[model samples]
Target: MASSLHIDLHKISKFVNLSIPALFVVFLSAGHFVSFYFHFFTVAFLFMVIANFFYMTVQKEHVILKNFGLMGQARYIIESIGPEMRQYLFASDTEERPFNREERSEVYRKAKNIDSASSFGSQQNFDPSEIKIRHTMFPTPKEALQPFKITYGEERGLEFAYTITRPIMISAMSYGALGTNAVRSLARGAKLANIPMNTGEGGYPEYHLMEDCDLIFQIGTAKFGVRTDDGLLDDTKLAEIASKPQIRMIEIKFSQGAKPGKGGLLPKEKITDEIAKLRGIKKGADVVSPPYHPECDTVEKTVAFIKRVQNVSGLPTGFKICLGKVSEFEVLVEEMKRQDVYPDFITVDGAEGGTGAAPKAFLDGVGLPLLVGLASIQDCLKRHGIRNKMKLNASGKLISPRAQLVAFALGADAIYSARGFMLSLGCIQALQCGNNTCPIGITTHDPELQKGLVIESRAPRIANYVHNIEHDLEELLRATGCKSFSELTEENLYIPSDTVLGNYRLNSPEVQAAAS
Candidate 1:
C-alpha cells in the first residue's frame, strides 16, 4: 500500500507544473468572496489542465506534445508567427528573398511621391564578377530624345495592333487572384499612367475595363473567360471579348515564372461569389487552371492557334512562357519560321517572378532565372533570323531601373512588373498572399480589409510609380548615350568574368556553323 501511494504521488508530481498554478487560482477563488473574473479564470485554467492531460495521452501527431504536454504548445505558437517576427525584426534591407526591404521601400517611396534618393553609401557589395552596363562619359542629349514608347505587331500589320505608350506596363495579375479593389485600382491607375494592364489567365472582369485602360486579354490553358460550357474555345465568345475597344492585345499564356508547367490555383477560401461568376466556376471550389493549353497541344497547333486568335480578334496576339525544355522553344521558333507564322510578341517570365500561390518545387527549382531565359529566347529567335518579326517583353523582378536596363541590354524590348505595382498599392510583403487574409486588402476578399485600400487614393500612387520608373529609365538610357532602347546592344554591356561567356546569340557565324 505504501509503495502504490508513492508511485501515484510520483505521477502526480510530473504534472505539478500545471497543477500548482491551477491550485493557486482555485485557492484564491475559494478563499475570497469570488469575483466573476476569478471564477472565470479558475474555470479556464482547470479546463486547460484537463485538456492538456487528454492531449498528452491521446495526441500522437507530435512527440513533444505527448511528452512535454501543454508546454509544447509554445513551439507551435512561436512557429506560426516566426515569419512575421523575422521580417520585422531580423531581416536586413538588402536581404533578397521575395523582395528585399530596400526594394519594397523604393517602390513605396516612389509610389507616395516621396524623395527616393539614396543617401550615405551603397548597401550592395561591389562584386567584380557582376554584370554591369557601360555608361559613356558623354550621355545622349536629353533634348533630342523622344518620349518612352514601344509598338508591338508592326510586322504583323494589324490595324488594332498595340502601340504601348510606356515600356513599363502592368504585368498580368488576374481578378480572381487579386481582390476587386486591387483590380479596379490597377485599371484606373493604368489609365492614369497611359500604360497597358494585362488581364491574367483567370479572365477579364468588368473592373479591368472599367477605367478605359488598355488591356491585354490573356487566354490561359482553361480558357476561362472565352470557354464554352464544354470547356472548349468558343469563337463567338472570343469575338465578343475582342470587340471591346480597350482590349488591344491577346496573350496566350503557356506558363508563368513562379509555376512553370504548373496550373494556376485559387484556393477554395479565395473563390468568392463574384470570382466564381467571373471565372464561370462553381463557388466554394478550388479553382485550378489546367497545366497545359487545351487548344495548343503541338507546335503547329500552337502557331495556328495564335493566328486564329489574331484573325478573330483583329488584335496583336502573343504567348507568355518561362524557360523550359530549351529544345522545345527551338522547335517552336523553327516551326513558326517554316510556317511563315509569328506571334506579335513573346513575354519571357523569369523564375523569380511573383505569383499569388504556387508549390515550393515550382517556385524555387523549376525554371530559368529571367536573365538567362530572356537571353536564351532572344538568341533562339535571332538565330532563326526571325527576331525582327516580334517584340520581346521581359517580366520578373524588374522593379529597379538597373534591372530594367540589364533586361534591355539582354534584348528585352519592354518590361512589366506585377509585384512592383502591388507594392505601389501598399503591400507590406507580409507573405500571406496564399492565404485569403492579406491584411492590406490587396489579395484578400474581406470587406473590412478591402475598405482599407481606397482606390481614389492609391490610384495616384500607382501613376506616380509608373512615372518615376520611366523617368529613371530615361535617365539610364541617357547615361548610356543611347538615343533609345533600339540603340542598346550586347556589346554595350559587359560580363565581368575573364572566361568567354556562352553567348546566347545564335545567329553568329560560329554558332550557325556549330549548329550545322
Candidate 2:
C-alpha cells in the first residue's frame, strides 16, 4: 500500500510541481520515512485547506483585488497550472480537446521521425444519436507525388493553378516586436522547407533579408513602417523589397481576427527612436494607428492601392481580412468586377485569432470565426462569379493535418500557423507573451528569455513539423486516390455530423467554365 502511495505521489509531483509547501509534502512522502511522514502529511493537510480557501473565495479579476488585494496574484499562480491540472485530474481520453494530448503526443513522436499511428479505438467517440455525419461520393483513385505538398487555397483562377507543398507556413507576426534572431530564424526555417513566411504589418525587417526565403510583405492601415512623404504607398521601398527574388507575395492588412476594426498600438517604451524615424512618428509618444486608411476608402480605392503595389512589385498581391458583414463583401466584389481588378489571393482569419496585445472587447467580440468567414467568403465569391479571380488562405488554429485539411476542403488554398511555431520554440502556452517576461523567448523582447530560444536548433524543428504534417496529409490524399495535391477537390471531404455520407459532390460556381 505504501509503495502504491509513493508511486501516485511521484506522479503528482512530476505533473504539477506545485512550487508550494503542499507539494513539498508530496515529495518527502515518497522518501520512505514513515515516522516523520505524519508530520509531512499534517503540513500537507494544512496547506491544501489554506490554498483552497484562498483560491475558491474570490474571483481573480475582481476590481477589489486589483485595487487592494493579494487575490489576483494567487489566481495567477493557479491559472498557470490550469493545463497541468486539467490533464492529470479531470480530463479523460474522451474529454480532452482543442489540440488534445493525443494529438500533441502524435506531433512529438512524428517530429522524432517515429511511426506514431493510431491503433484500435477511434481518435474520437461520437454520441451515437446526437452527432451528425457527412461524406463524399464517387471518390477518385489516389495518385503519386511529393511527400509534404498539398493544395491550400481556393481553386478557381490564378490561385487554382498553384499548390502549397507544406501546410505549416509562418504566421503574421511583426518583426519590430520580436528580436532580430526571431525574424531570422523564421525566414531560415521557411527557406529550408520551401514554404513562405509573412513579414507582419511592422514592415520588412532588415534581418529578414539574410535568409532569402519566400516573403509575404504586409501593409497595414497605420502605414507606420513603410510610407512616402505623402504618407501613402512608397513606390521606391515596395519596388526594392518586392524586386528581391525571395519576395513571392504581398498582403494588405485590412483587418485581423484578434481585434477587428481596432488599430495598432505601440507603447511609448517600444517606440524606439529607430522605429519612430522609419515610421515617421514622433518618439516617446503612444503610437495609435488610424482606424482606416486615409489614402483609400472604397473598394475601388482599395483595389487601386493593391494594383499600385502589384504593378511596381511584379508579384502576387493579396489581402488579409476577418469578415464582418456580407453586404460589405458584396460591395467590394461588385467594385472589383466593375473595375476589372483582381486580387491574387485572400486570407481569412477566424475571430479566435490571437495577437501579442489587443483590446479585450475586440479580442472576444469582433469579427466572424474563420470557418464562418471562409464559408461566407467562398459563397460570396462564387455568387459574384469571381471565384476564379483569386486564391484563398486560412489562418487561426490550423496547425495539424486534419485542421489544415478541413480548411482546404471547405475552401482555402493554404493555411498559416502562429502559436504552432511558438510551440516549436518551447512555449508552454503560459499566455505571458505580451509582457517582456516570456520564459522560452517565443514572444518577448527580454534578453534573458531570448537566450533560451535557440533559433538554430528550433528552426529545423519548425521545418520538421511542416514536413511531418504534409506527410500525414499525403496519407489522406493517398486514401482519396490523389497523387497531386492540386487535384484535391471538395468532393473529397464530408462532415460526419451532417449524415450526408458519400452521396453528393460540390461544384464551383464556374465549374462549367473550368470544364469547358
Off by over 4 Å in 2: 1-100, 123-164, 229-231, 277-281, 483-489, 496-516
lDDT of each candidate versus the true structure: 0.83, 0.68
Which ten-residue region of model 2 has the weakest summed lDDT?
A: 499-508
Instruction: Encode model 2's per-residue lDDT on 1-516: one tens digit a residue.
Output: 466436553344334424454555655675446666566665775565465445545546455343323334456689888877987777765565445666666666555456777788776654452212223343334443545444322332333223556755787887775666677777787888778888887765566668887777788777655676545777787887776777667788888898988877677888776676656566677876766676678778887887776677667778899999877988998988887887788899988787888888998899887766876788789888887778778898776677677667667867788766656555555556577666667677777878767778767876777778777776665666655455555566554333221211123234445677
Off by over 4 Å in 1: 1-45, 264-273, 281-288, 498-516
